[model samples]
Target: MTLELTPILTRLQNMLQGFLTAIPNILIGLIVFLLFVFISNLVRNAVHAIAERAGQPRGIALVFGRIASWAVLTLGLLVSLTIIIPTLTAASLFGALGVSGVAIGFAFKDIFQNLLAGLLILITRPFRIGDQIVSGNHEGTVEDIQVRATMLRTYDNRLVVIPNSELYTNRVVVNTALDKRRLSVNIGIGYGDDIAHAKEVILRELAQIDTVLKDPAPQVLVKELGDFSVNLDVRFWIDPPIRREANEAQDRVLETLKKALPAEGIDLPFPTQQVLFHDQTEETDGHRTRQREGWPSRGIERDPRPLREIRPNSEEVDNRS
Candidate 1:
């Protein structure tokens, strides 16, 4: 009985020693994981605070903070795994990543392209935040630039999310970048009216508008000879910083011109036509005359010649003076 007890006790002691040795490793791994999690959360909170202080949107800040925290935690987990299992190494991880790199690239080709374009836009700064811009067919003020798309607030108050790749390739028109912009109005005048008088009236109206810049002065030029009138091009410089005010000023100027010009007998051009009907009959002198059946004639004697007596002549008349 003593010999059997000794063997059983020896086996139990070996099992207890093995458990004691493994417990320390398990505890160390757990501690490391907890420390990494704590640090990640701290960094995330700090990042969010910084973004908030910098006037960044809370949503964007939270998204970036989460991404950063995930990246840090992933690195920490990889480190912990390596420590726990000595067989797993950075070289093996990189080799596997390289083997699958092509598949990953193909899967995220569009996403990578948009990310690169966004980076380029941020670096080059062709247009900045809150800039009124027209890119491709969309016209709006830029709100933000993210990894995938750029946000724009249209003039109508609609939010537009455009992909960055399209912006990189298409032309972008920045309307508010310059301090001054030009406004053009097409005006028409009657064919017989005095163009100079029309221009003077237009200039006077534009002078009353405060939003128009006086230094550059307003320009009036004859643009085209239209079907029934003369077209004039009225161009004036305006302060870009007050674009809405400038537009209102332009409208006022046009309205004033419309009213004042008409009052001053300066007629604005409109389409008109003058038509005449002719008779296919010729007099004895082979001269064509308008047909008037019952109208009194002037500067000619009323001859009682019969209508059938009228004859055609081919001889040409020499009336050179």
Candidate 2:
């Protein structure tokens, strides 16, 4: 029993001696790590302040500061670990970290992709906060842009969180990108109404609206001859291209047209159709010019016979029976 216990006791004593001898180094490593932590915080704050002063967006500044702080902290950690364990060489530490990094990258591939995509979006700035945009099947006002996702508050006041990778890869339509946006309203007048006079009235009325921009000038074009009326397309520009403003301008334009066009003797006609019934077995069935309802009047063709003068032939009667 004594011989067996001797080796265990000897190993314990050596471990205790080694620990006691390394106390000073451990203390020094801890102090260095704390000092690095302090310096990293200072670096983070400094980077954030500098970025803000350079007119960077708040979110972008925050991202930059976080990256700087993490880098400093990682370096500090590596240094402290080496100091605490003299056997840990720089090459060994780097090799371990490289393998660990690969594993971590594989584990969180989507997260890293979103981070990179978010960084790119902030740098490129396709759309800013408060801009109304349409992406994929979602459309809303951008509330915030974060490191992983973009927040949107929809027109109906619903919140949406979209990954930055999707925004970067997919198509996005920025509705309010321009200073002024054009809007069109289609109005139809009766075929008998004078097209030129109707156009003049519409243009004059549109110019009177306060929201309409006067620089580009409103346009009135004859769109097409509709079933019951002649369609006219009225187009005009409005400033501060927003959904609310666009809606209000459209409402005002429509109201003005509805009220002013009729006061100027322009007619807004309703859809109307005339359908006629005739017997196919009549003498005028195949006579183009003599057809009562569908054919034009011709000098060589006689008028169609009255309904009282026509009757169904024997074949049609027998079939019906």
Candidate 3:
């Protein structure tokens, strides 16, 4: 029995010795991987800084940095793997990846789609970080563009994460795409006021606004003769055309127009409705129709009180009847 146990013990000792022999190599590989991680991080930050200084968009810089970092880290991981397992070569690793890529792609189809879209966005430059945009139901400033999603900071201060695939495939409205934006305000004046004078006052008031663009020249045209007033559309252009600025310009214009129009004897009209009594229900017995004012003559009584104070004479009532 002792002799039989000696062979089994020898096999166990051999396996333990092999594991101990690989321990140092495994430790060295882990150290090398840690060094690669540190280097990759440094390179990522450096690339980001360089790209930003070069006047590229933040999203573009981020993409460049992330790609660089991931590439370096991937290389390091492969090298570490080779060190840990001497028999596994880089070619074999990549070959195995190629073989399994189809299954991995299927499992992460949406992720790949967004990654591709993110790359396209960084290249095409539709809208940049900090630009206000509207896509589908989302309207907000672009916070950041990521590997698989785009982040938005809404006006109400909520963060939204949207898949890049949607943004690339759908329409996006960039409000700040142009240096100047056109704005229009409708003003209604009483029909009795002078149309020409009202227009002149509006244009002159618009000229006083500092934010308004003068090159295009503000216009005040009669949109229509409304029910209670003459509707005039006061269209103008504003510079540095952000939503906030445009809104401020509009407020100033409205306040000035209101005061200016009134001072010029142009009354801002209120909604008014006119009623006509046609007297369609009139008593006509093959003769002239009843007149409204004299339907009951002035001599007739319109008293509606109950007669309880005086008793009428029976004979007088009989004679009048």
Candidate 4:
């Protein structure tokens, strides 16, 4: 019994000595990790400021900044781990990371896809905040751009959150991307009216309106020989491509054309039809006759009664005759 206890005490003493020897190294590793964390935060802030000054989006800049800081901190952690475990090498660490990356990719495939798409959008900037865009059936002004989603304010005052991946994959129409947009209004003139004269009157009216752009010049083209009248397309350009502005300009231009065309003897005609009355009675030949029944006209009306009085005995003459 005395020999067994002596062997156990000797082994315990050796283990205790090894533990004490490792304590300082563990302490140093912990201190190094803490220092790395502090430096990482500083790096994050610095990157954020630089990107912002260079005109990058706020949300995207922050993302890049955070990535930089985390990368630095991760390197520091690897260094500290090496200090604690002297056998650990950079190659081993990277090999472990590669294996873990596969697992992470499989686990969060959709999340990573959106993350990558969001980064691409921030860099390319196909549409920016405050831009009015239409994607799929959704249309609105962009409010915020985030890593996973984007926020929009619809015309009816509703908020919409769309996934970044969907937006990136789909077609987007940016309405206000240009400073000016062209709009067309169709008006019909009587077939009898002079085409060249009507176009002249339209150009005159367009020139009077200050909202219409003069650089592109207004155009009036004969679009169609419509059923009732000739259709003319009046196309004009306006500045500040906004929906409301375009509508208002259309209304103003229409009103101006309405008042000016007729005053200038340009007839804006409506549909008219010719009524032919068919006398189907067997007593008379199958012939169509014209009759004016509803209203009096400026000119004299034609007597509908036939020559020699179709009915000779309908009116009795005086017997003395």
**Could you list the CA RMSD of all candidates, in the order they appear?**
10.9, 5.8, 8.3, 10.6
Clashing pairs in 3: none
Q: Candidate 3, residue 310: CA error in Å? A: 33
What are the models' TM-scores? Answer: 0.65, 0.74, 0.76, 0.62
Stretches of model 3 off by over 4 angstroms after superposition: 1-26, 49-55, 85-91, 275-321
Off by over 4 Å in 2: 1-45, 69-94, 279-283, 286-305, 310-321
How big is the positional error of residue 294 in model 3, measured in Å on the Cα after superposition? 23
Clashing pairs in 1: none
Error of 4 at 80 (Å): 15
The 10-residue segment of model 4 with minimum total lDDT is 279-288
- Write the residue-wise lDDT of candidate 3 on 182-291 in tens digits: 99999999989999988888888788888888988888888998999999999999887777887898999888988888898999988988663323212221123333
Candidate 1 local lDDT, 1-321, one digit each (tens): 335688889899999997787677667766787888998998889888988898765545665676678777987787776666557798897788899999999999999998788767765667777778888778888888776788988878999999888888888898888888888888888888899988888888888878788979999999999988899999988876444756686787788778988887877866887553222222323333333543335665544664334332323222311
Give one digit per residue, the lDDT tens place, for model 4 in 216-294: 9999999999989999999999997777788899999999999999998989887888654423222122222332343
Index of the highest-lDDT prediction: 2
lDDT, residue 132, candidate 1? 85
lDDT score of residue 5 within candidate 2: 83
Off by over 4 Å in 1: 1-91, 241-243, 274-321
| Native-to-model Cα distance after best TM-score fit, residue 92 in candidate 2, in Å | 6.0
| Candidate 3 lowest-lDDT run of ten | 278-287
Candidate 2, which ten residues in sequence have the lowest lDDT sum?
Answer: 311-320
- Candidates' C-alpha lDDT: 0.76, 0.87, 0.84, 0.84
Candidate 3 C-alpha error for residue 276, in Å: 4.4
| C-alpha RMSD of candidate 4 | 10.6
